[model samples]
Target: MNEKLRVLVSVDLDGAKARVKTQGHVTLQSIQGLYDVMKRADSLVPGLALELDMTLAEVEPQALEELRGCARSHHLPLQVDPLQRDYRFSILAPTLVALPVAAPMLAAA
Candidate 1:
Protein backbone atom coordinates (compact mmCIF):
# COMPACT_ATOMS: atom_id res chain seq x y z
CA MET A 1 0.00 0.00 0.00
CA ASN A 2 1.01 3.63 -0.47
CA GLU A 3 1.61 5.82 2.59
CA LYS A 4 1.15 9.58 2.51
CA LEU A 5 2.64 12.36 4.62
CA ARG A 6 1.24 15.76 5.43
CA VAL A 7 3.34 18.50 3.92
CA LEU A 8 2.68 22.20 4.44
CA VAL A 9 4.80 24.68 2.54
CA SER A 10 4.89 28.45 2.69
CA VAL A 11 7.23 30.88 1.04
CA ASP A 12 7.60 34.56 1.87
CA LEU A 13 9.67 36.18 -0.80
CA ASP A 14 9.53 39.55 0.86
CA GLY A 15 10.49 38.22 4.26
CA ALA A 16 12.86 35.60 2.86
CA LYS A 17 11.25 32.91 4.93
CA ALA A 18 10.22 29.65 3.32
CA ARG A 19 8.77 26.92 5.49
CA VAL A 20 7.89 23.25 4.95
CA LYS A 21 6.11 21.25 7.60
CA THR A 22 5.75 17.51 7.34
CA GLN A 23 4.07 14.93 9.54
CA GLY A 24 4.05 11.13 9.87
CA HIS A 25 6.67 8.62 8.71
CA VAL A 26 9.19 10.02 6.23
CA THR A 27 10.44 6.92 4.52
CA LEU A 28 12.21 6.74 1.17
CA GLN A 29 8.94 6.15 -0.65
CA SER A 30 7.09 8.93 1.10
CA ILE A 31 9.98 11.38 0.83
CA GLN A 32 8.93 12.16 -2.70
CA GLY A 33 6.39 14.53 -1.27
CA LEU A 34 9.10 16.61 0.34
CA TYR A 35 11.09 16.65 -2.90
CA ASP A 36 8.08 17.79 -4.84
CA VAL A 37 7.49 20.58 -2.34
CA MET A 38 11.08 21.69 -2.65
CA LYS A 39 10.87 21.71 -6.42
CA ARG A 40 7.78 23.87 -6.31
CA ALA A 41 9.41 26.23 -3.86
CA ASP A 42 12.42 26.52 -6.18
CA SER A 43 10.36 27.43 -9.18
CA LEU A 44 8.28 29.94 -7.30
CA VAL A 45 11.35 31.62 -5.88
CA PRO A 46 14.69 30.29 -6.90
CA GLY A 47 17.64 30.66 -4.48
CA LEU A 48 15.22 31.41 -1.66
CA ALA A 49 16.28 30.03 1.70
CA LEU A 50 14.10 27.67 3.72
CA GLU A 51 12.79 27.55 7.23
CA LEU A 52 11.68 23.92 7.57
CA ASP A 53 9.21 22.88 10.21
CA MET A 54 9.33 19.12 10.63
CA THR A 55 8.11 19.00 14.18
CA LEU A 56 4.77 17.60 13.05
CA ALA A 57 6.56 14.58 11.68
CA GLU A 58 7.88 11.47 13.34
CA VAL A 59 10.74 11.40 10.94
CA GLU A 60 13.59 8.89 10.82
CA PRO A 61 17.28 9.69 10.72
CA GLN A 62 17.32 9.08 7.00
CA ALA A 63 14.50 11.52 6.62
CA LEU A 64 16.44 14.16 8.48
CA GLU A 65 19.45 13.54 6.30
CA GLU A 66 17.38 13.76 3.18
CA LEU A 67 15.89 17.02 4.40
CA ARG A 68 19.32 18.45 4.97
CA GLY A 69 20.44 17.35 1.53
CA CYS A 70 17.51 19.04 -0.11
CA ALA A 71 18.24 22.29 1.69
CA ARG A 72 21.92 22.12 0.90
CA SER A 73 21.46 21.41 -2.78
CA HIS A 74 19.03 24.27 -3.10
CA HIS A 75 21.22 26.54 -0.97
CA LEU A 76 18.37 27.07 1.43
CA PRO A 77 18.94 27.95 5.06
CA LEU A 78 16.89 25.26 6.76
CA GLN A 79 15.49 25.52 10.24
CA VAL A 80 13.71 22.42 11.50
CA ASP A 81 10.90 23.08 13.92
CA PRO A 82 10.33 20.91 17.01
CA LEU A 83 6.65 20.40 17.72
CA GLN A 84 3.45 18.56 16.80
CA ARG A 85 3.18 14.72 16.68
CA ASP A 86 2.30 12.89 13.38
CA TYR A 87 0.03 12.82 10.32
CA ARG A 88 -0.51 11.50 6.73
CA PHE A 89 -1.71 13.67 3.85
CA SER A 90 -0.22 13.69 0.36
CA ILE A 91 -0.82 15.92 -2.66
CA LEU A 92 0.79 15.39 -6.08
CA ALA A 93 -0.88 18.51 -7.48
CA PRO A 94 1.01 21.56 -8.61
CA THR A 95 2.32 23.90 -5.88
CA LEU A 96 1.92 27.64 -6.08
CA VAL A 97 3.94 29.85 -3.73
CA ALA A 98 2.19 33.18 -3.90
CA LEU A 99 3.89 34.60 -0.90
CA PRO A 100 2.93 37.96 0.49
CA VAL A 101 0.81 38.47 -2.69
CA ALA A 102 1.53 42.23 -2.78
CA ALA A 103 1.81 43.23 0.83
CA PRO A 104 2.47 46.90 0.26
CA MET A 105 -0.33 47.36 -2.23
CA LEU A 106 -2.74 45.26 -0.24
CA ALA A 107 -1.89 47.15 2.90
CA ALA A 108 -2.42 50.45 1.09
CA ALA A 109 -5.72 49.19 -0.31
Candidate 2:
Protein backbone atom coordinates (compact mmCIF):
# COMPACT_ATOMS: atom_id res chain seq x y z
CA MET A 1 0.00 0.00 0.00
CA ASN A 2 1.23 3.48 -0.80
CA GLU A 3 1.99 5.72 2.19
CA LYS A 4 0.66 8.72 0.30
CA LEU A 5 -2.76 9.86 1.45
CA ARG A 6 -5.89 9.89 -0.65
CA VAL A 7 -8.07 13.00 -0.87
CA LEU A 8 -11.70 13.34 -1.85
CA VAL A 9 -13.25 16.80 -1.96
CA SER A 10 -16.98 17.05 -1.44
CA VAL A 11 -19.54 19.52 -0.13
CA ASP A 12 -20.76 16.95 2.37
CA LEU A 13 -20.74 13.30 3.30
CA ASP A 14 -23.23 12.36 0.60
CA GLY A 15 -21.14 13.93 -2.15
CA ALA A 16 -18.10 12.24 -0.69
CA LYS A 17 -19.93 8.93 -0.95
CA ALA A 18 -20.58 9.54 -4.64
CA ARG A 19 -16.89 10.19 -5.25
CA VAL A 20 -15.93 6.99 -3.42
CA LYS A 21 -18.36 5.06 -5.59
CA THR A 22 -16.57 6.16 -8.76
CA GLN A 23 -13.06 5.49 -7.53
CA GLY A 24 -12.92 1.73 -8.11
CA HIS A 25 -9.51 2.05 -9.71
CA VAL A 26 -8.07 5.49 -9.14
CA THR A 27 -5.14 6.67 -11.24
CA LEU A 28 -2.18 8.90 -10.42
CA GLN A 29 -3.85 11.87 -12.14
CA SER A 30 -6.83 11.62 -9.84
CA ILE A 31 -4.52 11.46 -6.84
CA GLN A 32 -2.52 14.42 -8.11
CA GLY A 33 -5.69 16.53 -8.39
CA LEU A 34 -6.41 15.76 -4.77
CA TYR A 35 -2.87 16.73 -3.83
CA ASP A 36 -3.25 19.98 -5.74
CA VAL A 37 -6.43 20.94 -3.91
CA MET A 38 -4.78 20.25 -0.54
CA LYS A 39 -1.68 22.18 -1.57
CA ARG A 40 -3.81 25.14 -2.67
CA ALA A 41 -5.57 25.24 0.68
CA ASP A 42 -2.25 25.02 2.53
CA SER A 43 -0.74 27.83 0.49
CA LEU A 44 -3.81 29.96 1.10
CA VAL A 45 -3.60 29.42 4.84
CA PRO A 46 -0.09 28.95 6.22
CA GLY A 47 0.64 27.54 9.71
CA LEU A 48 -2.79 25.99 9.83
CA ALA A 49 -2.48 22.26 10.27
CA LEU A 50 -5.18 20.58 8.26
CA GLU A 51 -6.59 17.28 7.06
CA LEU A 52 -8.76 16.09 4.20
CA ASP A 53 -12.20 14.45 4.36
CA MET A 54 -10.69 10.94 4.69
CA THR A 55 -8.65 12.02 7.75
CA LEU A 56 -11.38 13.99 9.50
CA ALA A 57 -11.90 11.12 11.92
CA GLU A 58 -8.41 11.66 13.31
CA VAL A 59 -8.83 15.40 13.87
CA GLU A 60 -9.89 16.56 17.32
CA PRO A 61 -13.22 18.38 17.49
CA GLN A 62 -11.62 21.48 18.96
CA ALA A 63 -9.00 21.54 16.22
CA LEU A 64 -11.74 21.06 13.70
CA GLU A 65 -13.54 24.02 15.22
CA GLU A 66 -10.37 26.05 14.94
CA LEU A 67 -10.01 25.07 11.33
CA ARG A 68 -13.56 26.21 10.78
CA GLY A 69 -12.69 29.42 12.52
CA CYS A 70 -9.69 29.93 10.28
CA ALA A 71 -11.82 29.47 7.21
CA ARG A 72 -14.37 31.93 8.56
CA SER A 73 -11.62 34.33 9.56
CA HIS A 74 -10.50 34.39 5.98
CA HIS A 75 -14.07 34.59 4.66
CA LEU A 76 -13.59 31.56 2.44
CA PRO A 77 -16.30 29.15 1.46
CA LEU A 78 -16.84 26.31 3.93
CA GLN A 79 -16.81 23.82 1.09
CA VAL A 80 -13.60 22.25 -0.17
CA ASP A 81 -12.41 22.63 -3.74
CA PRO A 82 -13.56 19.98 -6.15
CA LEU A 83 -10.90 17.56 -7.48
CA GLN A 84 -12.02 18.67 -10.95
CA ARG A 85 -9.72 20.55 -13.26
CA ASP A 86 -12.37 22.77 -14.81
CA TYR A 87 -16.01 23.24 -15.76
CA ARG A 88 -15.63 20.65 -18.53
CA PHE A 89 -14.56 18.05 -16.01
CA SER A 90 -17.61 18.91 -13.93
CA ILE A 91 -19.80 18.65 -17.02
CA LEU A 92 -18.52 15.15 -17.74
CA ALA A 93 -18.52 14.17 -14.07
CA PRO A 94 -20.76 16.03 -11.64
CA THR A 95 -18.81 17.62 -8.79
CA LEU A 96 -19.85 19.65 -5.79
CA VAL A 97 -18.20 22.88 -6.92
CA ALA A 98 -19.75 22.99 -10.34
CA LEU A 99 -21.85 25.99 -11.20
CA PRO A 100 -24.90 25.52 -13.36
CA VAL A 101 -24.63 26.90 -16.85
CA ALA A 102 -26.93 29.85 -17.39
CA ALA A 103 -28.66 30.42 -20.70
CA PRO A 104 -28.64 33.89 -22.15
CA MET A 105 -31.99 35.68 -22.13
CA LEU A 106 -33.36 37.89 -24.91
CA ALA A 107 -33.18 41.61 -24.19
CA ALA A 108 -36.42 43.38 -23.36
CA ALA A 109 -37.42 46.61 -25.09
Best by lDDT: 1
For each candidate, the alpha-carbon lDDT, in order, equals 0.52, 0.34
What's the C-alpha lDDT at position 10 in model 1? 79
* Candidate number of the best TM-score: 1
- For each candidate, what TM-score against the reference? 0.57, 0.27
Clashing pairs in 1: none
For model 2, the superposed segments whose C-alpha errors exceed 4 Å read 1-25, 55-109
TM-score of 2: 0.27
User: RMSD of each candidate?
Assistant: 17.8, 17.4
Candidate 2 structure quality by residue, lDDT tens digits, 1-109: 2333344543333222222112222233344454345445444434333333332222223333443454345422233433322111111221222133379998999
Clashing pairs in 2: none
State the lDDT of candidate 1 residue by residue for 1-109, as single tens digits.
1145787887788975577776666665666666667656655665555555665565555556665654444432233222221212222212221122244545454
TM-score of 1: 0.57
Error of 2 at 80 (Å): 19
Supply the global lDDT for candidate 1. 0.52
- On a 0 to 100 scale, what is the lDDT of residue 40 in model 1? 63
